[model samples]
Target: MITLLRSRRSIRKFTGQKISKDIQDLLIEAMLRSQSSRNIRPWEFIIVDDKKKLEHLSKAKQHGSGLIKGAALAVVVIADTNKSDVWVEDASIASIQLQLMADSLGLGSCWVQIRNRMATDELSSDQFVKQALEVPDNYSVESVISIGYPAESPKPHSKENLQYDKVKYGSFSKPFYQD
Candidate 1:
């Protein structure tokens, strides 16, 4: 399990293969099991399988061009803004769990952050996305996740690239456990 978790990497390229329904269900199950703040779990999921809509969403979202071309499925994870402030955090945790589960299931996935109106300087924006998906105004699209079989194997992360000693700590600078 640790090896699988450590080996999971963001895959940008994918073959034109379709994902199995069973695998999709497993991914959703993993997502459902994710921990939520106060167990509120204020999340709404939208699965985009339509080719035309995927293309449109790619244009709307900055990092979703790959989603249009490579993904077998694109999941729009929305959080209810009207709900608790922790809703966003809860939704985000669920998204991460889904991605990891997808990886374990021999699927590739990438996270595309959905910036709010304040970040983009367009107050009435995201209306286009909402209208396209037919999502209620109370919900805000938090992230887009693209999943598919990988076209190419991801490059392995180097041990030199990670500063595990600095991150692990017994007391700040002190190492938690000496290697």
Candidate 2:
């Protein structure tokens, strides 16, 4: 698992290949099994595969979104705020799980943050996704994950690139990077 974690990289370019139902189910299962605060699991997944919808979603944000149009599918992670106070954290965990699972399945995935962000037209990113997907008002969009077969291969993060300087022994004052 550590190796997998070390090698995982965000894939922003994808091929025209399609993902099978089994793979999609596995990714969903990963999210469903993710740990959440108090185990409330106050999250929902919205899968968008339609080309036009994906195009619309690509425009939902000004940047870090164009890749969705090439991805085979996009998973919109959402949470019911009323169901859990830590809904954002819960949804975020699930999103990472989904990305990791995609990597395990030899697929590629990248996360596009939506919560507390704005679209190109000044509309809230969450609201834009809700309007596009017809999501209920009770739920808030946390992120949108684009998944597909990668077109560009990115090298895994090397140990030399690790930010060990950010580590602290016990408290913030003891940071490894004295400077």
Candidate 3:
């Protein structure tokens, strides 16, 4: 897992190759296995592969979501607000799990945040996405994960680039970087 974590990077550019059904099934399983507080499991997954819908979702946000249109698959992560107070955290876990699973499967993925963002000055990204996908009012869109065969290969983050100063011991003043 550490090796996977070390090599994983967000991939925005993808080739035209479509993901296989078996691989997609594996990715869905990874999302389903995500852990949630009290196991409320309030999150839901939307697997979108249609080119037209992918193009539509690419505009969910103003600038950061354009990569979706090029992806072979995009998974929308959403949660039922009434199911848990920590639905955001739960949904976030599933989102990352999906990305990690994609990486393990030799696929590339990028996360597009939607919550608390805008599609335009007049529209909330959540609202725009929901309207496009026809999601229920009870659910909230947290993110859209774009996945596909990578067209551009990015080098893994080096250990030296990690901000070790952010780590601390028992006290915030005690830097754990020394350890």
Model 1 lDDT tens row, 63-86:
344455568888888888777688
C-alpha RMSD of each candidate structure in angstroms: 2.6, 1.8, 0.9
User: lDDT for every model?
Assistant: 0.77, 0.92, 0.96
Give the per-residue lDDT digits (tens) of candidate 2, residues 3-77: 898889999999999999998889988999999999999999999999999999998788878888999999999
Please estimate how well model 3 matches the true structure, expressed as its whole-model Cα lDDT: 0.96
In each prediction, how many residue pairs overlap at the backbone (N, C-alpha, C within less than 3 A)?
0, 0, 0
Residues 1-179, candidate 3: write the lDDT tens digits: 99999999999999999999999999999999999999999999999999999999999988999999999999999999999999999999999999999999999999999999999999999999999999999999999999999998889999999999999989989999784
Best candidate according to TM-score: 3
* Candidate with more favorable, higher lDDT: 1 or 2: 2
Candidates sorted by lDDT, descending order? 3, 2, 1
> What TM-score does candidate 1 reach?
0.86
Off by over 4 Å in 1: 63-66, 117-126, 168-179
Pull out the clashing pairs in model 2: none
